[model samples]
Target: MTDHESAGTPPGTEPAPAADGSPAGPAGRFLARIALGARHLAAGLRHILTTGHQSDEEIRRTLVLRQLEAHDAVRDTAREELDAVRRRITRLELAGAEEGWTPEQRQQVRMLREERRRREAAARDMGRVPFVPVQPTADQIRRARHKGSTVRLLGLLAFLAALSWLLVQRPALLAPAALAALIWLWWSGGHPPVLAQRPVPDRLLARPELDPDAAPAALTAAPGQDDDQDQDTDLRHVTTADEATARIAAALAKRKVHVRSVAPAVRTAYGWQADLTLREGTVADVVAVLRRLDTDFRVGTGRTLAEGSTDDSAIVTLRVLTSDPFANPPAPPVRPPLSCSILDPVSDIVSLDGEPTPLYLAGTSVLAVAVMGGGKSSLVRDLADYVTACRDAVAVDIDPTGRGLGPLRRAALRTAYTPEAAEAELRRLLAEARRRTADLGETEDVWQVTPTTPAIVAFLDEYAQLTPEGKGLAIEVLRIARKARISLVVCTQDATADVMGDAVADVFPIRVLMPCRKADIGVTLWPSAVSEGWTAHHLTPGDDHAPHDAGRCFIWAPGHKRPILRYVPHIAPHDALQRAQERLDAGLPTLTATDGPQAAQAAAQPIVAVMLDAFAAAGAEELTVAELLDALAAVDPGHWTQWDTRPDRLAMGGREIKRALKDAGLPPVPTVRSKLPGRPSAYRLQDLKSALDETG
Candidate 1:
């Protein structure tokens, strides 16, 4: 059995044990160490409630009160232990006959209610919130709380013993053990994280396992070195750790390699991972001054992810030196260019930022979950610059608030807004995702993207706007998050904890939090982020995730432990819109865009998407032409005067529709020859058809 499984390590997390197969791998061991504290507390609590061994009643009661205040295991927390004790008391009273309520029951409930009032009053006086954390952390976390364990154990045993002494004890008194076990399981079960499955050994995926004598591709005691290797060859047939390490030592030995000792490297499904620590040496020396003994070791470089504070750093990388390695994945597309109208700014990334912030995770996708204006809009704008145009790429925006493609109009295969629009676009993207997963799972040997084509990105902006529209986007985001091909950049201003309910929100395993105004904290943080009166200015955005300026962004790639601020190369949003128009004008085939005949309609009355509201107020009747003209004259006299009087639909032509459809990404529809089948041409704007529908 793996170290994690045998140690009762939580599933999906790395094993926890020392090197040589001890009971802790980093993944399992860290959690175990963390979990160990809880076990001790629980044991202590059980002893207190059941043992009845209190030397001093006042001291014991005070201990219970403080324990309740510090204890975090229960569903609800309290400054007074009475809150939890009352709950237990209430449970006991309810389950047992009302006659069971002793003087203790009434006292516990009274104290509990008193504490509740204190907390409630405290909450009422709080101020506005400042930001949102997609990643939820324990608000009341402490060094290590062992309060409940002892209090509960002693308390429970005392209750049982008291009942037995009273001559009314029942066999059910033993039920405490069962309850403690369940609670322990719950507390412990939550300790570990789920990690990606370990990749098959190179020998397993390639050559068949041979006998002890035969050894072409089996998990050999040591994999052999290769002289003429293909650039795209799998690591299984390439090299080994011993071979790579010697090169590393030779490269930096002269400077006094303060190597902390390299542990046995384990291969993952996507790549290999091992820890590296430097005592006296710096990262620059490892990269620049280190001379190459064998070209293989020097060929690979280190990649790190730094976040929260600039002072902290972790070494992460994908190396080409080892042969029995994880399968290499296609590099994710860089951020695509923004609108041609917007000037793209250079990023201080390579210099100011010490580590590379990869947009995509191999065998894992990225998740961006934040309340809006926290720089999500600009971040999407920046991502437009990360991806290349050739991966048959496209982006669809489900929001109808005019951010159809955000600033991604230039490189997105196509872009769209509105659920009706997003639905059509998602169907196509989802289809492709399903196709790749089933067809290329083995042949392409990739768990995610293809190298030659741009992967489709369906970014939903202002997702909360459609909550009233019932598009089920909340759930859809989660489904797409775990799948292949498509990556989601989801943005919303809604701070509701259970947006669209659980089904949809639960799927989004990854989340991103953004800067918020303290006043809006109550609405945004839900039960999360308890601060109030916080402002967007407090959030830092950068490649390593600091506070945001104009071009900065933050990322939380999978496998990363925290959010990172990043320097996103600035791309103009308007220019992105222009390029999207250009691509549409070029008749580029795309799934969706501001390009189809829909573009004309999309562009004609910017207010049309707002429907009659833009036409008038929130609610209005179907008005006559005169009323519309009057309204237009009040807001836009110039257009009102220019509008033709012909009620038979103004004579419109391709120029209007072509301009609109250019960004819709679909080709302009053929011109309409007749007003209706077998009917003569009606007096209408010939240009309107192009303006209205692509092929109408």
Candidate 2:
């Protein structure tokens, strides 16, 4: 006190009482500094606690939104420039007549107009930029909040506990510690000069930072190098399903096609596929834009394909082929074991994605339609090879071409090379089906094929070449042969209704459409086959005497609701011949007499027999055609009762009867008067007896 009085000459000054009535000494200043440090510490801790709680997904979403906002800013700038150019052009136009502008002024206006057009194009391009939303799920937010709350509570408690300990044991050092911590936090808040001066990690940059010494060479690099790098970046950016969808959307938009949404692309061995919902367009629109998409995606021509969805007209499936899927076709399926069951799938058909799909031949009729050199014969040979390798199956070849079966003819149980033989085989198959139906138990629907009673697989090649009666017999067999473990594989080059009737084409449960006319697909397969992604018509056929996409086909089966592109395995003629010989050496199974001679006799009996019996029952000398038909219906209701009434078959009443009678070599009986409104044609009982006697 004495020293202070001597130095300042102010008695009882007490540091002159600071602004807040505190002593203006070192202690007050120290207290102020400590308070400032505490405030800084609090703010830093608060910042960490608040920011640390954000989930990675939330941060990513924020970043994406920011990027989109940046893009919007760029587009707005382009629009502003466009508007400015338009205004300048307008000003020049207004000044030209009044001020009589020179050549330079007119050229300036023209250049401004060009600039406006370019800016407009740029703005449009920006608008077409694809955007896919990525938002955090409710569950993610819940879990993140829970974890952040737990961590923040624990941190707060830890800080409080440490402060309490410091106050109890080392209160003297608390202020200094707080001060040091505040200084450190402030120092770390900014980018340190030492670290900021150094180059960032290469992985952190979009493209690696060029070496200082090589920068000159990089600048001098060819322009193609930059183009290549840009292309690579474009390709790499589409590594994910979301990215692919976005890219495809952008590409389609450039062609004036808008889509509501595109499902995530599914990766396949061939390439990738995605289903899209169009905003307001047909599938044909999408198909039209595929060529441009190929160019945009850098895929080669014919790599992109679009098909309408069968369920909805607005839905389309887009397939992008990245590579040649059939560049390396799979080897032929291995031969079956010593005695494979016919119930199992016979061979493997490789799908477009290079996956092996089993081909089921039993319990299903197959219709294969293809153009010339479309590999129909090769498919037939492969099927025959499989059948010959099975112990519970026998092959029947009905080819009017005689050579359609190739060397596999050796494996057939019965080979028919003429229309008459084909009809005979069809009748025998029908009889076998009838016999099997009668033999089944009440609870059993399908006959269980065995070695002793094997199933029959009839291969009817050149079906269009068959006679009308033969075609009719084949259709009859198809209608009833399923339960008897008998199926047909009918191959045809023409699939028109006149060539292959609707009734015959519709009966097949399995359809194999090879390279043919586009119209043939709808006729040979289902009406919705083309819409369901059956693009067999797009497949290339042989040209200049060379096979192209010969084995490619779209397989539509009962189990497959949508058509799948498949490649039928090719079996060489020598391989097929060897397999046939092996099967013949093992001794094929044969049907018993009940299924052979007796069943054929029953099937071969003419419709005249029923008519004759009806005449006998009527006990009349003469009856009109209508009266005879009615009598026949009562005698044999199974065959004659609903003959002309079937919706699937052509309706012919009297003409059908006359045709049958004429086929039996019977003379036509004249019309008779039976007191009816119209004098109808009649068949006399004596004439029926005479016809039956002559045919016998």
Candidate 3:
């Protein structure tokens, strides 16, 4: 066989046999095969290691504590293992010699040991060892210490660098930094430590057997421990505050604590605290003492065992402060519910404050204001009660059909049905009003007109019913609304529109609306002020806002109706009634519901019978002035005398009388008609004697 180096064939091809022409034998071929197998095994191991395909056991072996030693440490460990193996081999040889071993056995043992040693040495060189940090030489350490000193000096210079720049800018910043440095030096450097450093022990710190009362030892080897054979821990040393401070100083000294100064013990609201300053000794030394102290004896705030605390030697707080004595609890918050209500009516019984402003209806600024409901009749009934409360306050009602004003007719200052009768009655009322106005002009103050002579409130219902001379009585209402002593509240469903009439525009300063479906009416009455963004949509009618009822009305007086002012509460119902009734029951001419005289039985029978029959036949929940107008607006708008100024109501008695006369076979009861002014055309049935002979 020829060596590959001397062979001159191509580079990668195998060499031919030598001139001896001997083929490569089995032993060499077997060795070549073994070498190839080893190369393949090495390639497989490389793939596993690089790609992390190695088994868990392989990784564990690679990263174990033995493999994780520092680089030099691992080398030293390898060398030591080699030495041990060498020693073992030597021992094995001695044992073999003592046993008289054969040469073949000895050779085999030596070969096996040599192979194992080579494998271990190879593993050591192949990057199996962890890296160890290089240790600096003594001179290098000295150079590092000098560099550290330079860094510290540079730090001090850096602080001055800011001041120097500031000095360059203004030349004023140096004085303060210099002064501060001087103060720091004086405070830290000049102060003598109260206790000096002494030797301490770890065992003594862990479970300290301290003798604060013991006498000073001649020389304390382990100064923090009381180790003399006869000496014991002095438990009495820290009994008083002063003694406690001294003991603390001694404990600190044993740990070589260097503080600037020690402050006297101070008392707090809860307990006592001691302020301490450490100077010469480092933070590491003081940390040992801090950990050794009682668990309950916590460090104060800002107190860290950091070396050189002159930079920020703030005191640490151990406990929290108590809460303030004056702090108030939070109040619960909730939203107000939405609501509205009609607060103004004669019998509404509610005042401006939503309290009762009862039986008396007087001094209402809303002259000719209208209400439309069955409930308003209750309010009108109370008007009689109000008139009784104020003697001079007269109520004039014209219930033509005996529906509304008829019940309280007797209490009216003047009651009339037909337009002619109403005109006559109103002439009387106006004469009284003109007289009262003249008297009021003479009075010093308007309110001083006396309780018996309070302002009068004339309430009128179904305002469109009265039409005299085709001009309509709404015009007459305007005159009374302006000139009469009493105020007017004229009620009708559709009166909110042109029906309200411009004639009374100057008189009615206050308008109280009950609910209505008409959005325009609410906006007209409210005019969107004092409602805080009052939308027409928010004005729902009725007493749904009964809770927030009082402020619902839009008050519109000259000086009193400013937008900024909140609505005042209304007077309640029952209280207003009592005040009115008291005046009337005192015989002060206060009008009352009961003050009216009951009509004769026959007359009442006709009214009650007609009312019940109309209600039953019509089946109306409630009759309204607007619905009645619509009912009559279709009818002869002119001949609606039952709704207007027609005196045919004598027809009831007249019809009965004429029928009786005819049934008895007598001449028809003579019909004599009055050509009364401002009245409907109608004939009246009179007695035969009177009709036949005026001479008699």
Candidate 4:
């Protein structure tokens, strides 16, 4: 056969020779078929790797078992393309060797190795750095643990030693010296509890610490650097009070506040006190600088009071808290279990000096003044919950608009939404207050909770929204604050003279000044606050800054020098609802129009007429009040039960029966004697008939 014809028979297999001349062998044919099968297997593997049909997991499994083995590299393009598959398989095998033979184990080992390497590198870097000790704080330096006084005592002992030596030289002087020493000791012991004499104030000192030239780089660093550790480290060399003052001065200057000089830092009852003499600036400029210290500097600032200077420049006194007062604000006070007294633990005061001040909601009324969404309503709701929880407290809410107190209106015994309704409720409450006062009489000035004397708390929200008549009623209610045991909590958005009249404002000795629209309004609530530079205008509205100052406000009670920072804790709405539901389920009825005095008057008239007719039919003009009550009970047991019985009563007493009689419109038991001389006072049947006839 020709060479071309022979080449046409494919590579591994050949067509069998038909006739004579062509050679054919069984062993050759078998070897050719084997070669063909091997070639097909290689093609399948190439296709798999090129197409990426098999997953990585499958590829790994096949490579590990040697089911699909890698081939040698080649220079030709076609062979080189196949060689990439081998290389990929080899790389995967190497990776498997480095990792544990299992995928999950491999991942864990890789993470641990990475972590170990990172830790070792960190350690190497840390070893190369120098050690720097933290500097002692200013408070640490000033707190002597009575060491200075102890040193003074030692000096006194030394003087006494010298005196003893002199007496030893003259034996006769011992008796007189001993007596003098005893008298001195007695005098020292009898000294009043007054503070030790302090040295001249830092403001009065002309020390080099007060020299602005000493710190030419005053306020060189930006306010943001105050929080940097590097900044604190740079201050380690600040060994004297002068250096601290210079650092503060530098911080103020960086915020564009020109400072003439700074006084040496001095310890005071409030905190560190320093006077900063401004370079011809107003109080507004000083306030602007203080704002930067708190905002950009990230430092807790206290009151910054501006005083007039003789040189025409203002002297601003700075107070920096040693620690952040707001760092760990106390949680809102929890409601105590139901008790007879009207006292409650509501909020905690985070005083300017980082001290915790507890607020006890007792007999005093509270006035919360702020703009809308300033957390005033939250405070009111919390107190309302406490009032509703107390068994003796009568929670009455008055909101003419009904928006503020709507959610918790169910908790109130009497909720008045309209102006007319609110006025009526206020009048009734005033009457109740007068009645309570009369019950206390001169024998007891303070109200004590009995079944008869319940605490009446009128929680008035948005007092500025009250109508003319409602405002008048509110003024009347406030007048009975201490005298009639009536407490008023008046909340207003604008606590101006027009909104909250002086008489209404004076009723609430305890005031919470929330963030208002103007500082003057805060001053209206706390008159003395202007002098101390205390204002709530900086507090952010709503719960946006809740973690910092949501319920936070400046609180002024009767005995505080200035309004203090207090957090009026929030009560969960669900909790309030649950408490209210509990109260309602216990048979505490709502005080609606039907439950008012007019309703009682209408209801009692018919009953009175029936009883009077019954007495007249019995032909008795005069009968004892007890006998009349017995005749009524026999006629209508249900009406008698309504008037005479109280559910869930704490004790067995005649108070319920007496209350029933008064509620039925029966007059108080007469003191006039009966004709029988020894009998009880009598009710005239003829008068009852005449009263029934007049109604007809």
- Which candidate comes out best when scored by lDDT? 2
CA lDDT of every candidate:
0.39, 0.66, 0.38, 0.53
Error of 1 at 681 (Å): 34
Can you write out model 2's per-residue Cα lDDT over 1-696, one digit (the tens) per residue? Answer: 343222222355333458778657787655444444444445445544554435444443444445445656887888778767656765665465334558998578667756765786787687566443334456655665566667887989999898889777987987888777766644433311111122343332221112222221122232233343333212223567777776666566555565777788877666768888976657866765666777777775546778787679888888887766777887776674346777888556787667666667776789999999888987888777788778788889898767757887987888877765665566556656766766888899988788777888999999888876567667767877898889999999998644674335667888888888766886776544564556677777875576777887877776665555678878887877777777778787665433333233323445654554344334457767666666454434455667656653223556777777777666673444556566656666665555545555
Name the best candidate (by TM-score). 2
Put down candidate 1 lDDT per residue, 472-591, tens digits, no spaces: 433432354344446666666553422322123333434444553332333332322222111222343334343234333333334433433343344456665665565555443243
lDDT for predicted candidate 2 compared with the true structure:
0.66
- Residue 340 local lDDT, model 3: 9
Write model 4 residue lDDT over 430-500, tens digit each, in one string.
55555455556477876675334456678888777776656765666566656555688888888764355
Candidates, ranked, lDDT = 2, 4, 1, 3
**Of 3 and 4, the candidate ranking higher by TM-score:** 4
TM-score of each: 0.35, 0.51, 0.28, 0.46
Give candidate 1's TM-score: 0.35
Worst 10 residues of 1 by lDDT: 127-136
Two-way TM-score contest, 1 vs 4, winner: 4
Per-residue CA lDDT of model 3 for 634-696, tens digit only, reads 222343334334344344434543454445344443443334443422322124323323321
Model 2 stretches with alpha carbons more than 4 Å out: 1-247, 262-268, 282-302, 307-315, 543-546, 595-696
Clashes (candidate 3): 50
Off by over 4 Å in 3: 1-375, 378-384, 405-410, 418-420, 435-455, 468-484, 517-696
| Clashing residue pairs in candidate 2 (N, C-alpha, C atoms within 3 angstroms) | 625-681
